[model samples]
Target: MNIQLRFFASVREKLGMSEQKAVLPPDIKTVGDVRLWLISRGDVWAEVLAPGRALRMACNQQMCEPDTLISEGAEIAFFPPVTGG
Candidate 1:
């Protein structure tokens, strides 16, 4: 499926892009799969998306879990967890 990807904060700086269009393989059926797939790209992707990293994700602008199913052209975002004082 084709999806829109958005990066935020440090992730954007590292990836050198705030947004892009991606075509995911059939094996990437959910948000988590996409994460792993991106990480497999190596280098910055591996570091920023490695397992155990404290990352946040959203689908179509609404926060979503890793298990969430993604649809064609859906917007998916990745960012560091938010904190407030």
Candidate 2:
């Protein structure tokens, strides 16, 4: 499936890119799958999207869990957790 991936805040800085269009393998079906797929890309990707890492995710602008189902043209975003004091 084809989708748009977005990175924000420290995640963008760490990854060195903010967004990209991606064509996922048929085995990737959920947000968690995408995260795992990306983690396999290399060390940097693994560090940023690691399973135990603290991050926030969203699908089409609405916050979603790892199990969220994705679709063609869907937008998935990753970012660090935010805090305002």
Candidate 3:
């Protein structure tokens, strides 16, 4: 499936990217799957999207979990957790 990916805040800075359009493999089905696939690229991808890291995700502009099924042409976003003083 083809999907649009967005990175925000610190995540964007770390990845040196703000947006990307990807044609994912068939085995990649959900948000988490996408992340893991990206991580397979190694280096920065693995570091930034590491499984133990604190990150936030969204699908089609709405906050979502890892298992959220992704559809063709869907938009997925990732960012560091937000906090306020």
Candidate 4:
């Protein structure tokens, strides 16, 4: 399946990328699966998307849980948790 990926805040800086158009493998079915597949790329991807990371996710611009199902051409975003002073 094909999907668009967006990175924000520290996640973008850490990954040195802001956006991507990805063609994912069939095994990647949910948002969490996407994260795990990205982590498999190693390096910064693994560190930023690893389990236990304080990250937030969105699907098609709506905040969603990791298990959220994804479809072809969906947009997925990952970012650090927001905070205000």
Model 2 pairs in collision: none
lDDT of 4 by residue, 1-85 (tens): 9999999999999999999999999889999999999999999899999998999999999999999999999999999999999
**All models: lDDT?**
0.94, 0.96, 0.96, 0.97
Report model 1's TM-score to 2 decimal places: 0.95
Candidate 2's TM-score: 0.97
Model 1 lDDT tens row, 1-85? 9999999999999899999899999888889998999999999999998989999999999999999999989999999998899
Candidate 4 stretches with Cα past 4 Å from truth are: none
lDDT per residue, candidate 2, 1-85, as tens digits?
9999999999999999999999999999999999999999988999999999999999999999999999999999999999999
Candidate 4 at 53: error in angstroms?
0.7
Residue 36, candidate 1: Cα error in Å is 0.3
Weakest lDDT window of 10 consecutive positions for candidate 2: 42-51
Q: lDDT per residue, candidate 3, 1-85, as tens digits?
A: 9999999999999999999999999999999999999899999999999999999999999999999999999999999999999
Cα deviation of 4 in candidate 3 (Å)?
0.3
